[model samples]
Target: MAQQFEDKFRRKFYYLRLSVTDVCNFKCTYCLPDGYKPSGSKNSSFLTLPEIHRVVNAFADCGTSKIRITGGEPTLRKDFTDIIRVIADNSNIQKIATTTNGYRMERGVAEWKEAGLTHINVSVDSLDPRMFHQITGENRFHQVMSGIDRAFEVGYKQVKVNVVLMKDRNHHELPLFLNWIKHRPIQLRFIELMQTGEMDDLFTKHHISGVTIRNQLIANGWILKVRENNDGPAQVFVHPDYQGEIGLIMPYEKNFCDSCNRLRVSALGKLHLCLFGEQGIELRDLMQEDAQEAELISRIQMQLQNKSVSHFLQEGNTGMTPHLASIGG
Candidate 1:
């Protein structure tokens, strides 16, 4: 039996968000408003495939069953499918997922599915093409929509669409999103805009509480779904009249970290205990050899002891995270 990855608060982690790279194509207003700028280095400093395999193996040994491959845009990597295959080879990993921008889904999703990708979460901040273009600085709104359709055609039972709910941006389009998902098996997630080191001004101007939407869903007869062990921090709700579901991710909400089950690893191989926590613990050196699995797991467990009971977002503390893309938020 695998060992449980439990923190001091007895929060057992079953999910791992592993970032392969920080190179994104989309220039979202909230995340990469200035677009992705590579560090002044010719060589890509992202973790290698062997390093990723070792990290996943160590996590799997500690009972991590779900691994979400994240990035500034994960699909941009040429070896993305190979990365999926590597994780899928491990019997202990039951689910292999990715959170993407959906730019390559139309052309590359079939190959990704064949490589054993089980779940996909695509960021679609706005349904309006013009608004989408304005928000992301990309004119590929229709292309992304078509990619989602292709995802369904290639055998995805359901797709999760992420929308960062900003006050004056796409908040008024809630009804449109509800209608779109009424006939589709989409889990539309509305994430509250979070305060990051670089986007404090934007967060102040556009941040909206997800409680407004959550209360609306409850009043409209949407029932809350019981969360699974490996589920992320989304509070999902379902309605009898609609085929789709709705999820709310409000990090600023009280006790948000009580059910914490996921940890993040940056592309540089540092383990992050909390998204809004301090600088992460380095794990790359231990990943150099397969024989270091035991030590790797030990270091991970040791770091968990330092994870606080909750994030200090209420205290206006965003920690060391400069931007969401920096650590694959």
Candidate 2:
């Protein structure tokens, strides 16, 4: 089943972003649908744990050395810890991380650590309770804050706080959010909300550029000294004398597709070439066929061959659906 395939840049993609579920407990305003209702459909329960392992192992055997677990909220999955352990135990994967909403970390951090989760990224838009509630559409501010504190106490070396920069929504809180890392061990990342998912219509409405953000930070005397991560995205820097670092994930403003080396797997097992991909190869179908490692590797190689260099961020683009939550943002 191993078909010959490769991309233009000669960069062998070996990273897989796997979404565990499309079930999140909280309805964040930016993420939830217009008339939202929680529906963990039998078809939408996402891949079974066994199915997930099969897919991950297939990638690992194909030279995938890094993996990140994401979801509507990956922690919500009952077997999340077990899944983490399985990926961690895989000798081919060097790093294992999860992106979460932070509401559950308070009660699950220790157990998650025991399960071999090495790094964590928490979505924290604002520190103010009222604004936090407005942005996330949930009154779990206290719980989220407590969870983040618990993450620090649990001994996670790289606990990154990801703040999606929304134009007029939480834009004013940037300085305050930056202050959270003044003397803390946690890293902070300011992300430009992409024009994708259900929020695609709001592209022109809420799109905030990275240049504006950098200028604002400089205006407030937050000097940025560039720091680089050879294996990861995000152009990072440190505020002078700051404890950790500040990372700017300017996917819209700056294109890093030339050196891109990652592919995303939807909760349903589709292999997306880019975050804004219109379609993906059905890995679940391949798995159901009882394909061997070499065969699976060939499918991945074929998927990567179709990987485009950059994504179109134009307004009203119906490039993809299932939202960022469904696809593991």
Candidate 3:
């Protein structure tokens, strides 16, 4: 693919985290810990489907080959599957994926897979019913579990379980989580808490290191191995006898910014260059006003030039930051 979008640091941008909607079914403690309910952006504030395509096409034209549809629960959007179809039909895009809360799988998984969905990552912090309810402020544990099971039953190229490991919260259940997935083909990933302000205080109270998790896995007879060509941030490993592999994402311990290859466009059309970033260029109005593609690309290029080498979260300060929902986490 020809290169078009490169940051000031010379990082070629080929991945997009597109938040199709800001509405969600549940507010997880780590995501919306403060239970903030921002007044809805005017309906006109969000881009129409055509607008979404224009921005996507601009990025694709500029060499973006991967697009992940995220949400406040993207499935909540009446046209969620259509977004997948649109990106898949774009010949410039090579892969399509989603980070879903996993409630609508039974209704649309096959359709989405047929639409060229290549990967799915489900957020499942706990397997225990009580803790799951406590953490998410809802009683949808069984629903989420069934959704994950259904995802495994599907024929996608990759399906992953995203576990946010926090001390005393879901960290101790690592063994049980692994045992539960011992017979499945899904990848089990334990993620360190991202200090993305939504969980401000909770981060310090429950944070767990990926290194500690790594040591425990080694101590428990799990051997370390590497994927031949995998280069996404997760430190992937596999046990000789386990049916599925494991991953540990140490955002705090490791700096993935040097190789960052993605950018995000929020539901309201803000261009976010980094997850923990405080600034973004406005693009929604340009889209809504029917700006020329050249203008759109120019504005996008400006934001790309503004991209920083690293997010301050790497410094380990747990102050308030962007809300994961609105920021397209």
Candidate 4:
């Protein structure tokens, strides 16, 4: 089925970003606005572990070989370890990974690694503890940093840290942040902030472009070198005289939609063709109705074929649905 995962763009859709839950522990200013209330009830809907297993199996049957479990914060889910085991057990899945905030990582990262999680991508915006508190709305900086150390201690060598670039917020921390990961084995990713989630204000206020970030890094005397040239976005780089690599994800400024070979599955089972697109196929209905495996697989294939060439919002346009925490980056 891996052959079927090939898209019209000549790229293979081996990776599937699966959001297991929408509930998060942080209240980042850009991700969620103040006084924000969800349109749906708190306990309204979420895919159970069995349902997720079925969906993952279906995706595997369609040639998805890599799965990244994400969430509002995947660690917040109690059954995360069990879910990792299920993903690891899948014969078709070549790699199992996660993108987390690392707040609860101190408590569960080691165990999670034991449960078949091959690697982790932790989101750490700023190195300053004070600024970290301001951005994450939680004063657990020391703990999150410790969690990164713990990941390395547990032999999770493929660790990466994602720092979203925001003007006037932590954009100035680029050089400082790079220095922190310059010699380390972990890969440092500097992402350009998008106008997604509740970033209507921040998008207008602190929207920073990826080119701006690269210049800033070079200006600060950090010579970035190119590393892996993977197809899944994120322009990667390494230091001229350093070991660890640096990555830039310019989803807004430099659109990689032409090579976009991936699809997102919201925690609630919505098949989002693009991160900035509102329309999605509701797999929950099929799951609830005990849809057959063949039907489920066919529905996913149809959705993939129906995927847009690029996101409508990628051109600085608007009019997409709000994905909330269920849509992972």
Q: Which RMSD values do the candidates have, in order?
A: 1.2, 3.0, 2.5, 2.8
Ranking, TM-score, top scorer first = 1, 3, 4, 2
Q: Considering TM-score, which of the candidate structures 1 and 3 is the better prediction for this target?
A: 1
Question: What are the Cα lDDT values of the candidates?
Answer: 0.94, 0.75, 0.77, 0.76
Expressed as tens digits, the lDDT of each residue in 1-329 for candidate 3 is: 33489888888877888888777778788887555475455653455688888888878888887888887788888877788887887898887888887878866788888878888888888889899888878788788777766665777645788888889888899778888768777788898888765456787799888899899878877876663221456777777777777898887765667768888888878888877775566887666444566678888887788887787576865433466787667
Superposed on all Cα atoms, model 1 deviates from the true structure by an RMSD in Å of 1.2
Best by lDDT: 1
The residue-by-residue lDDT of candidate 4 on 1-329, one tens digit each, is 52355555565576788998777778777775442344485545668877888888878887777888988888878889999998888888877889898988887988998999987899898899999889888898999999998888888876789887888889888668767866788788888777764467678898878888677667756564442212347676656666577788887654467667677888878888778876668887666443566787777776666666766556566446553464775
Q: Total clashes, candidate 2? A: 0
TM-score of 4: 0.90
Residue 165 C-alpha lDDT in model 2: 81
Off by over 4 Å in 3: 34-36, 40-44, 218-231, 288-291, 316-320
Clash pairs, candidate 3, are none
- Give candidate 4 regions above 4 Å deviation: 6-11, 35-38, 41-43, 216-231, 288-291
Worst ten in a row by lDDT for model 2: 223-232
Model 3 residue 225 distance off true place after TM-score fit, in angstroms: 6.4
**Displacement of the residue 206 alpha carbon in candidate 2, Å:** 1.9
State how far residue 104 of model 3 sits from its true place (Å): 1.3
The total of clashing pairs for model 3 equals 0
